[model samples]
Each structure stands twice: as C-alpha cells, then as structure tokens.
Target: MAGLFANDSEQIDRRTSRSICDAVGERLQQSLRPEPRLPTHLEQLLDELKQRDRDSH
Candidate 1:
C-alpha cells in the first residue's frame, strides 16, 4: 500500500525545501546568543557562593 502512504510528494521540490530550512536555521543561529552578561546586582550573590565553597573545604 505505497499509494496509501504516498501522496503529493511532487507538490514541493526537495532541493528548494532543504535550502529554505537551512537558511532559516542559519538566520536563527546568527540572531541567538547564549548567556547574556549578568547584571552588577548579581555579582554579590555569586561572590557569596564562592565564599561558601571556600568555607566548605
């Protein structure tokens, strides 16, 4: 029953579909950044954790 599973494969060209997806993924990767810099207020909290670790040792 290949016909049951297969329908309208010819509606979209495979190469064009692949290129569109690749371009979209590339644009998203370029626009996204990881871990923005922490604000100054958080610095003290980070320092406290460091001190706690030091004391634990």
Candidate 2:
C-alpha cells in the first residue's frame, strides 16, 4: 500500500512539473517572439541615419 501511494505521488509530481514547464516554455516563446516591423517613422529615421553615416564617411 505504501508503495502504491508513493507511485501515485511521483506521478502527480511529474505531471505538475510538466505543466509548470509547459507554461514557462509558452511564456518564454511569447516573450522571445519577434516583434512586427518598426513603425514607418522609425524606419525613415533609421534610413536617414544610415544615409548620414554614409555621407560622413
């Protein structure tokens, strides 16, 4: 009987651990996901900067 209970407890622990890992993995993926392209104004600013750098050199 004790052995059975121990097995059940271990199984529950494994499931809980897996659930926590999955949740963490999902959150990490969302945080690491690539953002959409920069806004048009930002893009333009970057382009201007690049042009200025090239001209300066």
TM-score of each: 0.44, 0.49
**lDDT per residue as tens, model 2, 1-57:** 667777554566778889999999999999999989999999999999999999999
Best by lDDT: 2
Q: What is the C-alpha local distance difference test score of each model?
A: 0.85, 0.90
Show where candidate 1 strays beyond 4 Å.
1-10, 35-49, 52-57
Model 2 quality (TM-score) = 0.49
Q: How much is the lDDT of residue 25 in candidate 2?
A: 100
What would you estimate as the lDDT of candidate 2? 0.90
Residue-wise lDDT of candidate 1 within 1-57, one digit each (tens)?
677647775456889989999999999988885778788879889999999999999
Backbone clash count for every predicted candidate, in the order shown: 0, 0
Report the Cα RMSD per candidate. Answer: 4.3, 6.1
Q: TM-score of the candidate numbered 1?
A: 0.44
